[model samples]
Target: MDHPLLLAFGLLLVVEGLFPLLAPQAWKDTFSRLIGLRDGQLRTIGLIGVALGVALLVSFS
Candidate 1:
């Protein structure tokens, strides 16, 4: 339902904002390090994230 979807998005925003809100310097440092990663490395990380998300959705559904 729309309610559940909205709650999911809200929770996602909260979780995504935690690092920057609680440890801004650390978050910036992480971004700086990420900037040095190769495109292939970034792609691999993204693929893993997508795969994990899909696996979680499948298990939950």
Candidate 2:
């Protein structure tokens, strides 16, 4: 509760766990498709996630 970085990482783990816990097959299928994506496509998706996270941090914090 006192450490923001630790709390954020913990929350991330919870969020990351949801898909597999809720639908393991779907999660596996999604990753299989993601594995087939080009490197640029994966980079773009990662960039989008980073951008969204930064935007949310700026807006909320």
What is the C-alpha lDDT profile of model 1 across 1-61, one tens digit per residue?
6697799889889999999999999999999999999999999999999999889888998
Candidate 1 global TM-score: 0.89
**Candidate with best lDDT:** 2
Please state the error at residue 22 of candidate 1 in Å.
0.8
What is the C-alpha lDDT profile of model 2 across 20-60, one tens digit per residue? 99999999999999999999999999999999999999999
lDDT of 1 at 61: 87
Residue-pair clashes per prediction, in order, are 0, 0
The predictions' CA RMSDs to the true structure, in order, are: 1.4, 0.6
What is the TM-score of each predicted model, taking all chains together?
Answer: 0.89, 0.96
Mark the regions of model 2 whose C-alpha exceeds 4 Å error after superposition: none
Error of 1 at 37 (Å): 0.4
